[model samples]
Target chain A: MMPDHTIPPSNIASSAARTVFFVSDGTGITAETFGHSVLTQFELRFRQIRLPFIDSIDKAHDAARKINEAYTNDGKRPIVFSTLVKHDLSSIIRQSNGMHMDLIKTFVDPLEQELGVKSTHTIGRSHNVVDSEEYKNRIEAINFSLAHDDGQSHKSLSTADVILVGVSRSGKTPTSLYLAMQYGLKTANYPLIPEDFERGKLPSALPLFKSKIFGLSITAERLSEIRNERMPGSKYASIANCRYEVNEAELMMRREGIRWLSSTAKSIEEIATTILQEIKS
Target chain B: MMPDHTIPPSNIASSAARTVFFVSDGTGITAETFGHSVLTQFELRFRQIRLPFIDSIDKAHDAARKINEAYTNDGKRPIVFSTLVKHDLSSIIRQSNGMHMDLIKTFVDPLEQELGVKSTHTIGRSHNVVDSEEYKNRIEAINFSLAHDDGQSHKSLSTADVILVGVSRSGKTPTSLYLAMQYGLKTANYPLIPEDFERGKLPSALPLFKSKIFGLSITAERLSEIRNERMPGSKYASIANCRYEVNEAELMMRREGIRWLSSTAKSIEEIATTILQEIKS
Candidate 1:
């Protein structure tokens, strides 16, 4: 019941660190994401806990007890971000000595009223495996992305939804995987190496799939920092080498008429969204 | 402004299919997720569109126009799930002919009152690359995961946060990548083939990391179905072979006292969360 000491203290001296719980009947990913997004607007440190699969009444009681204990230990009300679907279970958590934010019910009631239809009130529906086809496509996309990473395979390049061309450490692999995992997009990432630059042409397999190809570029300084982490003091990680590679890659993309973006300041989500927008549009 | 005929009609005879917009100044991922979770409670069909990076006033006006157009085209008010931080932008969107669900503001107001603090009202904060160390760790974990997938290397087995063992098509690779991408966990997945079952022991390198190992099992029917998608008529897709492999894998996990789960009915999120709970606890 003790406060989690792992969380660093907040800047506010008058208030103790608040214990925040992401309680859900499902995997709790949505609740955690929603809570994290809202909490980022404030300048406070929170001791975070995730209590997933609180489906049964007994589990709900247990979660309520834990929330109450945190409140008692911290001498402040804990923040509970809940996505529980069942009315009884959510009511139990709401009774605890904490500020319970029923993230789902808060919007669901209004939606039900607006639509003039009652909700199903099903538990674990958000992350459930009801749509088997969608699930299979996601798994297939992940496998395809892994197989095609860094141009490891060229047999099925035509099947790719999008192909990414970039220099080493220009944020291609992570972006490719994100697109595959989140959107079930088959992505193949090929690194535009110095050999291709010397040849002054695209990779052999890339010319045919030019329309589906998108490019990613990074600033020389940022690319050097990333590469240096892998191979310190090597010519590959040198700033001059990075500058030349970036310049050549940009020129190549321009000549090939490939749309590109710099990933120096963008997160994987932003990069993936931009790519999806470009390709779909 | 015409109705998108690509979307099939809703089951309801009288009402038309609704249009849902996930509008945000950032990637709109959070808004889309939140809206999707809420909408799943209903049986009505919706054509969802994501409008990300609506940061500028001009873009906000354009998004408002799109929403209004959808309302006019569909003869039903479109549902707008907005996470806009700027007051003027949100107000403009709210003035449109749609039901605007200000997801962030609804919670932010109550949170500000409870904490007696004003929010920063920042844009693009959730998925922004503001925390460089955390971002670097995520990228590193991703690279480490890709390199170690399917037991591709034994060089850094000891560095893995958790290692997964399962038969082919038992859902290990996707789970490993999900753990790595979402939680920054370095996960290595190894397939338990007939060789391991015949030997009647864990993999040679796995025994060294026994404490960090977890197992996944699936029903024979499900395993056969999945494998059949890859190789239609091979022995690998036969129910008898799938049954034998799954039985042997379960026995191996039980004999070794390793914790495991049935992935037959679980989504990747559920499986990954369960594994994270098991390993972390």
Candidate 2:
């Protein structure tokens, strides 16, 4: 089969089309995520493939055969990003006709040297070892965020580590989930509905958790765009309504002395980490 | 300040306590996530500090000073996991009294050699570059997942890339969200309410999108435990109710020719990737 050269050529050199593989004994997410980060530095594009849960010898052999096939068909050595933890499996993958970049084996030597110990050489432990206390905390945090989403429940507000208050479509749900998932922090987000804005004060449900409340605000243009996607041509999606709600929400947060930040031009990671830092401070 | 040695020393050496820092020009999440994956190979404890948004010279200097302080306080060189893209900022970090593992600078030269192209060497480009068309798709996916969560809306069911169904608290919401966040796939998740179980069949709304439907099931005990946390001692949390719901949901999915998997022992990453593979196949 001919290689795919349909990707628009740019400033980067594209002498040959190459395939990249993310192979792991577990979810392959860490390998794929970090490999993508490193690959972003280079301008060349790749046909990315993910092969996860290569825990058995048979699976490892199957992955090797696939990688070898790509190498021969593409007329170039494919790049393999791997996190196979077992030594035998790593050896099997290393024998493939590809540039095997094994993150686990590459770092294990130096870590053992630095820590003065032998590595466990265990597969899937890092990804699936969720029976510990830390993992349980993460699950509990996830449950908290889901229950408190959109102010669905308020019975457990006192248990919340942080409560996010924002106008509708201001990027509250994703931010809340990210914070809980990454930092194991129980986050609850409440939307500022027309009733709250009409009251000209912080919502009555918020006073009990005043110290734990943080606010999220967004640009009127962006808010209107998001709302319009859901309910086009409605009053809620109008630019004038978005602006009015945004202004009133910001004023309410300021009057209540609740810290607020704009979600405009920011990724969920950026928003979550900023909130985590503020909460720590 | 005294070093923290409260961590139980096992096979690994504990000559001195060390502080690990995840430094980045943007959110520091990619750096932290990948660094933690690498660090898991060893059995040592670390005090992790994240210093993000170090985009300027002043912030880099601040981060260097913090790393230097940690080195002196801990009486050992701290381990720094950095994705600093700019040469000048990275040089500042290198000058600190720490072991700086620069993912960008270390791999860029080798990749340039392999690809025969110079890297962009741009700061904060890897994680924060989201203005492209790909990013717009991610936002659309997130919005779709939110709208369809808990079967809130079936208006856009036809547009979904994957529709997930499960009993309440069977790990549908987070899996759907993760699939959207990572893969830019429009995912919709529905909960099998009591009424649906009574009907003894898949929901009528699901049959039209039968090809896109995936079912998630969990152990009855686990489901009961999860539900009990929210509505303790209620019928919804009763072990008998949970067992009945899970059995009915599984049978309904099987009878409808829908693929189903258990979330009892799998992480969200694992579940999402498995479903992605099935969909692709």
lDDT score of model 2? 0.81
Q: Residues A68-172, candidate 1: write the lDDT tens digits.
A: 999999988988999999999999999999998998778899888888788778897633453445566678889999999999999798889889999999999
Predicted complex 1: DockQ? 0.47
DockQ of each: 0.47, 0.41
CAPRI class assigned to model 1: acceptable
The regions of model 2 sitting more than 4 angstroms off are A1-16, A126-128, A193-198, B1-17, B126-128, B193-198, B231-241
Which 10-residue window of candidate 2 chain A scores lowest in summed lDDT?
A1-10
Instruction: Tell me chain A's TM-score in each of the predictions.
Output: 0.94, 0.91
Candidates in order, interface RMSD in Å = 5.6, 6.1
Clashes of each: 0, 0
Off by over 4 Å in 1: A1-15, A126-130, B1-15, B126-131
